[model samples]
Target: MKLNKFWATAVMASAAFCGVASAQQGYPKQPIRLVVPYGAGGPTDAVARIVGQAMSTELGTPIIVENKAGGASSIGTNYVVRAQPDGYTLLVVAANLVLNPATGIETPYDALRDLKPIAALANMPILVAVNPKVPAKDLGSLIEWIRAQPESVPYASPGAGTLTQSWGEMLAQKYKLKLTHVPYKGSAEASRAALAGDVPLLFDLGGVTAALIAQGKLQGIVTPGAARAPGLPNLPTARESGFKDVDAESFLGLVGPANLPQDIAAKLNAAANTALKNPRVIESIRSLGLTPTGGTAEAFGSFLSDELKRWTAVAKSTGIRPAQ
Candidate 1:
């Protein structure tokens, strides 16, 4: 009877432990690290900080925003892809997550396969920006001028594998323009080049160059979205600017190492959705010239896959093959 009782007690203890483990599986028992794979003050960093702060409140723990910028976001992205699949480490992936892989570059990690998307955070519209010295006042004049003197006009982008670079290439191919490609170390540098008139065009996210346009230091010819930016509703979209199919925007999202627990991912996605819905956070994100979007992991995953296929075709058509 003593032995039987002891065995029953062991079984009960195991069941109790299993219940505790199951309860713990609900997620976010500790602080989480949100890694922004870009320099501080960049668009990705700005969005990550805002979302991270609001999510911290919803999760009942501090969500730290860590800037890990370098190698076209590869260094930081690879760091997170290699992190433990636990919910502790998360990444703020940008459109470059898809563009980089399509560029045939030696990225440290594969975005679609190595990381499981948690939620989409925001979308930064791409703008056709130029310094005031460009002389083209609007999209039509700019197109005419570029068509007349394609090779003479040079454009700047954050890097070769970035969305800006991809857009510039696509624009060149679509319009049969001969714009020179000038890749900068980062978006800030590329925007500065446009501001200084070193580059005549900027095919980059509006968040990087919107202030210059507002201050009249730069001009916006078009944006690569179906609709004008809410911040600049007066500007026309690329489709309206005469290129009916030139719709593209830099999408931002959160992801973690692949194979993350479904329950943990669900909790994180809930917190992110809550964060994006915060009024103050929404205002901040819009002020940066982004449209906020927080949705299911499945939605984000599908979006990523579509982007990969779309940009891969873009790269192939633009002759952007992997460097030997």
Candidate 2:
């Protein structure tokens, strides 16, 4: 009787191990939901759909894209944070994930604690632009014009707790420019505001502004990074304008809820990387003025950690906060 009991326990243990292994081996037994924490037709949503479609083919399953925009992106973000760790639900968001935590934007879940980085999808160089009616034609003139204003000039950013906001504040502080921040829900809305001259100046994603600038609806001032953006070669770099210290750029990446099974995370990361490699997917992403960036799960996580640290320091120095 004792021997039979021991054998029964051993069999059960083996069966459990096999069950887990089988599940991981045959992952994505169902459709995967890719959540965007912003409105549809926005850069975040666009990237999610393009990459999600390609990943669907790689994983042999449909990748459903869903937008849960609101609360400064807290709504959809929290939705993924609370999802099951079975890898069915995921998130594709921007650098705001780190910005929210670093700038104390009051998110429902902490990104580093509640999410797992799967893979980086792309990098978007942030640009400073103004309405065509604005008197400034270049970065220097814009700075000069802002300083000469009698009152604080209004500038628009994607939202509070974003790199654009921090960068805008940094510029105001560095140059003593009297600039008032006007935060919007996302890049798409902010661009529209800038287009309608509701906001004279804007710090927005290059991907969203390239066409606007090309059509002469908006005037591009400077692209803040190490170099000029390829899509907007006519636009000078911050370094050219002598504002080389501002190296702000937006990042887009994929993430899942924390404690997700390691195997599932690896599978998703592989699929994302593979999807990013496809030629059509590459062209689609670039057409939006975003650079395709794909790497290991570990590398993406490290990037997030670095970004979190960097944004924290910026927030401390600038006293930046989300708009009430």
**If scored against the real structure, what TM-score would every candidate get?**
0.87, 0.85
Clashing pairs in 2: none
Runs in model 2 deviating more than 4 A are 1-13, 132-137, 144-152, 184-200, 240-242
The number of clashing residue pairs in model 1 is: 0
Clashes of each: 0, 0
The residue-by-residue lDDT of candidate 1 on 9-126, one tens digit each, is 9999999978756865756777899998888987789899999999999989889999999777888999999998878999999876887778877786777889999999998888
What are the per-residue Cα lDDT tens digits for candidate 2 across 208-324? 677888778899999887666657889988888877777777889999999789999999999999999999999998888888899999999998999899888878988887677
lDDT of 1: 0.84
The lDDT for every candidate, in the order shown, is 0.84, 0.88
| Residue 67 CA displacement from its true place in model 1, Å | 2.4
